[model samples]
Target: MSLPDIKEALNEYEFKWKAEQVTIQATLLKEHSDGRVTGDITITTQAKEYHPHIHQSQFNFSAGRTRETLAKTLHSRVPDLISLKQWEDIIEQLCVKIVAMIREGEPALELAIDDTKNIPPEYLLEPILLKGLPTIIYGEKGANKSTLSILFSICMLLPWKDNPLGLVCPTRSIKSLILDWEQDKEIVQYQAKCLKDGMNLPYFDVYYRHCARPLANDLPQIARNISKVGAEVIIIDSLGAACGGELNKPGPALDFFAALRELRIASIILAQTSKDTESKKKTVFGSTYFTYYARSVFELVKADEIDKTSSDIALFNREANYSARHDPIGFHLTYNGTGIMVQRQDVNIGQFIKRHSTQQAIYEVLKRGAMKPKEIAKETGENENAVRVALSRMKAAGKIVMTDQGYGLLSKDIMQ
Candidate 1:
């Protein structure tokens, strides 16, 4: 009815639909008729021309129907004839047409979350963000640790159905520079093959650096190179290859870590935990600084008797100066037709309990002696409600006893 309304309708229609028979060269132009703006749409093909009179309200609807019908019939033939981007454009235009009809009936526009200032760089990052930090994948020998690292690299570069880690979404495009000192050329080729097949994404600038010592002299140079390429993430395959300088001292490692932060890039440094029985520490290698320096650590462990390997993903809180908890989130690895695939496995309750202080305190209280609900709450320094909840769970697990004297932990399961 109005000029603005008609213009809006046409624009919406353009967005919602595409020409069904593109064999018909289509031209849409506006004209004024009896104080009302109308559209004279011309459809010209190989042979004849068809002129269609489209009103403001009906323009979008008709366009959508035409597009839908044509798309269904020409689906198989369109890809062979047009480029992917062109096909995308055609589909997008059709969507616009369908959306135009509904726009008028819809309520006034609502404000959306302003993320223009929030978009990260378009480069891909490997070892995708989990728990707000980059993670290093480490495991025992023969565990396919590198394979897992490659899988992570692929996950970050590819578009997954949901966010793998419960971190922020609509992440900035990331650029990762992988320094694979281990240098298994075959595996690298396999990844490239996966990328070609679209099984994995090759959006990042991938580089293969083969050297005995990736950390000596090469570390800073590598950082500069990735900076030039605008990479936001870097993956150093193994700590052994990447650690040539004095690791015990903070000076060397500190500079390397600082360079990464300066470039606004996160690093995933994979390292192996030594097998010697003399070592008491649980982390990969080095002193507290290794774990201390890293923002997050994911330890991959192999089942002693079982054929499968498990990965425990841990979130390290820098401010707190320790992992909020140490129990690793578990995953099972298997080889699919293409390559190694990882599926999240079961939760480890023992690890889970040790990591949680409240749960530990409750268990401790029940272990010492039997006490009433109120007594147990006081002894555990927990609230009545919390104590009751813990008691219920412990009882369900058969870890605690409901005695006439009070609540007692089953001694057999006390240490467990």
Candidate 2:
């Protein structure tokens, strides 16, 4: 029997082989870690009314089990759907072509290093986001992590220069996408509109998708979507749903990180903080890989001050791979029925950092007029000994002035 030539589609993940009135399509091809090529092969007819002879089922490169299953299913379910000999020929061609496709690319190549100090790590937003790497922001639900991403997308989409947010956009303009797992398209749409209208900028598009499947399972479709829009960056609304389920397990974490690596695009991933009151430590809520694999990480915090129209938000740098972790970035947000606005501001240092560090708490108390160590302890809710120790260190560091009045800031801007 002559074998039909299988035609590879423009998308490397798809292939087709035609025989008689039926077309066999192999799609969503993936190479496993063990080097096995697996995909779905559907047998369909080119008729006015569409019906699948063998609805898509997963098949490996060898196609032995799949071929037998297809044959048995056809013979038992619907007799003589296709001749046995024709089926054998299609399976043989399919196996050969699948093997070739799986083995197409070189595993490794010669190193190409043209110069020393040639290229520095590129940044989409300096100190916050590295270009083409994942950045994580995890916090309590109402901390506005998702809102921050939306604003970042706007900054890049509008190509804001001397941006009010204090983060520089290195490129002229960036194309971005949003994959929302926790929210619907309508919510994101309204948020985008309110933000843009508040800034008084003309409307523009930022590609968006509402996602449900695990990123690893849905990479091909996501890749196609990214390619279609020429998106340079992606914002995954939250991490818990993106890993599918059982996010605490190592497998999902590994798979999620691998999927992001395969994506090869700049990303801002929002995550939830693990509820750990005992340690007073906040991790990315699920797997440690969510924090470890990410190129940069931040803990988002909203101030305790009650403001109906505004939020005092800060992104505290937790980790950075390319450089030192930075001082927290402070942004003030004001929103109402018709508009939303974000602007750079000094962190409301006292309330936001008080719980995390005794130094910060002491610093906050001393920012007002000078006070004795005993007074500082009472004001900051700390032990007198601890406050005394901190004050001694602060004086040695030239951060506080010692006077008849007691300890105080050398100047208001001393910390800066």
Candidate 3:
């Protein structure tokens, strides 16, 4: 009948509460003659002061119900009366507590086991440039490095068949962005026209930002633009012009690469080689950081007897982290009447001649008839030991046969 009497009756119930800062107060509001009790409960939080945080809600129970039953009923129903904002605040507090617990190392780290087989690296060009990885294409001045970079961009932007360099595009189509900091708008436009006309495409899926702001200062905007265009691959033409500080310095170089990694897109960074550095290792014009961070590195060098402006160029795979180094591939950047075009030479004479000179000489000598190793060496003017090595290799490759008379071509069908 009285509030104190009702409180005393409810205190006998063994109701376990989870929140130490919260309290519930129940009052008997009415008593029905047919042995029913109607009441309301007020839920509040207690600090130094009591704060009514939840709206009061009615509860009904039979007169004969035990304190345990009443407490349990109230416990279950009180949560429903809490406001949405109160619930959100409670969840935020719990999250903060959980974060603190984690920081205190209450829970051990979790390990996830993946049963899937290891996947191979995905590449734009097999063994050369991988998807979602950074690559550096560096060359001496006038090596047509920009042309090569443009070719790559064109390949990625247009249909695979339109790719003049014959690079394999894993996807049906790829959107590419070219941030050309070195070239002017007119030059870039001309180059783009040439690529479009040469590929015989009305237009390409490529976007170009000719002569962009320096990379060091405008990385955020560049990253946003890449995302805005949904670019799968981005090319930064000429790292020196894009970068703000000296490229030879580690701080600037690292910062530049860090910005690139943040874009999370496959990137090709074009750079110039230092003069007087003929060797591939020293030619990359920046700090070792560039090579260290790059997933692959390629060098383009002008072939001997070729004019600096000539289309003939040699591409050498200097580094490949995911795949074996590919032999140098020859590319000619010729201009048709309509546009500039790149064509892969049928034969990579530089690599072919370097790797197979002895084999070629031996084969030429054997073209006439079978001959002993000494006779082959004397006829070909090759070292006797070298001839023996070449003969052994050729024999194992089924290119040649040794009979009682001498060694001879296994089949005349072999190409010279």
Candidate 4:
């Protein structure tokens, strides 16, 4: 029979030919930095009443190297080990096919998003993570971004509908994998256990993989694990360590995302802000390309230190590609001794920008009653001047009207 069919899995090609106990396989078909097409090959043999043997090694996609690697790999003496000549011939055939395949490059599909069809954007996690795209949640140290992700992951893994997190999930459960570079499995394990217990879940079994290398360098193994665990959603535990290169450089940033895209699954990547972010405006602590490449980004801000049980947090949409920037959503995570509860709270916990826009926050509060600028400022924790400026802008934009009472929206149903 002819050589086995080559199948593309992400950025690699996998090929295998088998007949009963005699089998041969090839995988990881991709190029190296020096422009050589290389991959791993394996040969396995077992025969009736004879010993079974296996041999595996890296193979270069060239006739000369294939011939050398194949010659001594199998011989007539070992039952089912094809004759030397036959082995060489099979590898040679594989080399020729792979060389041609590599030169031709990954197949491309024609692009079309015709307006007539009008396909809407899809989400793996509504309003938080997009389906089959990359989204980020970045914050300073101790902000509990990772823990927040774990809470979301449980919602998706069990995929609880109408869950308390207020995040929507598909009817079907999606498996999740966490690739941790910042923390080891033990820490993650403890965190997972606590969350599971706190959430009162009977079971929480999302997969976890410890990572130290750049994602691209670990694609093969990660892909294998993804397949093994049936992971559809991946949570990258922070970006700095995963980058595995100069965090400030575009090359590392681009490569890291390219690797994620190659995995071809929905991803929620956790990231850290620069050390001085609290004193300055917070941005993801990496190349600007990180921001550019991401489909959506959220800046998570924690209000204060966690004393024992509760912490207030706010999520500000820094960028969104597919939809309108969301109103700031705030949450209060209460970790009681037995369980954890995440509830929607006013984002106005501490001194930071709160929901929709400051204007929307003001309008929401104003819907209760018209309040003066100082009252609005007091309600939102915004300095009086900033609230007045927002109010003035809202008036100029025809969004708000000044009245004897204080300030009011021109339209009551701003949501409309």
Model 1 clash count equals 15
Stronger candidate by lDDT (1 vs 4): 4
- Model 1: per-residue Cα lDDT over 1-416, one tens digit each: 10111223211132222233232212232222232222222222221243232112212223445545444434444444434444445544534533444333447888788756765333233223433244555556665566556555555554343533323333544555677778776667676554334333344434555556535445445655775766556677777657656666675566445433433556677777645534323455554566666666665655433433234433222222223534334555444445444555544433333233455566655655778988876765567998788778878887677888888877785554
lDDT of 2 by residue, 288-337 (tens): 87888998999897887586898898888888888878877888889876
List of clashing residue pairs for candidate 4: 124-131, 198-339, 198-340, 327-356, 328-355, 328-356
The models' CA-based lDDT, in order, is 0.50, 0.77, 0.64, 0.77
Candidate 2 lDDT score relative to the true structure? 0.77
Steric clashes per prediction: 15, 0, 0, 6
> On TM-score, who's better, 1 or 3?
3
Model 4 misplaced regions, further than 4 Å: 1-29, 32-34, 41-91, 103-117, 278-280, 353-416
Local error of candidate 1 at residue 342 (angstroms): 1.8
Sorting all predicted structures by TM-score, with the top scorer first, yields 2, 4, 3, 1
Per-residue error (Å), model 4, residue 16: 4.7
Residue 223, candidate 1: alpha-carbon lDDT: 50
Error of 2 at 273 (Å): 0.9
Q: Candidate 1 — which residues are off by over 4 angstroms?
A: 1-134, 163-172, 191-207, 211-213, 227-229, 249-251, 258-262, 274-281, 305-323, 336-338, 348-416
Error of 1 at 305 (Å): 5.2
When summed lDDT is taken over every stretch of 10 residues in candidate 2, the lowest stretch is 9-18
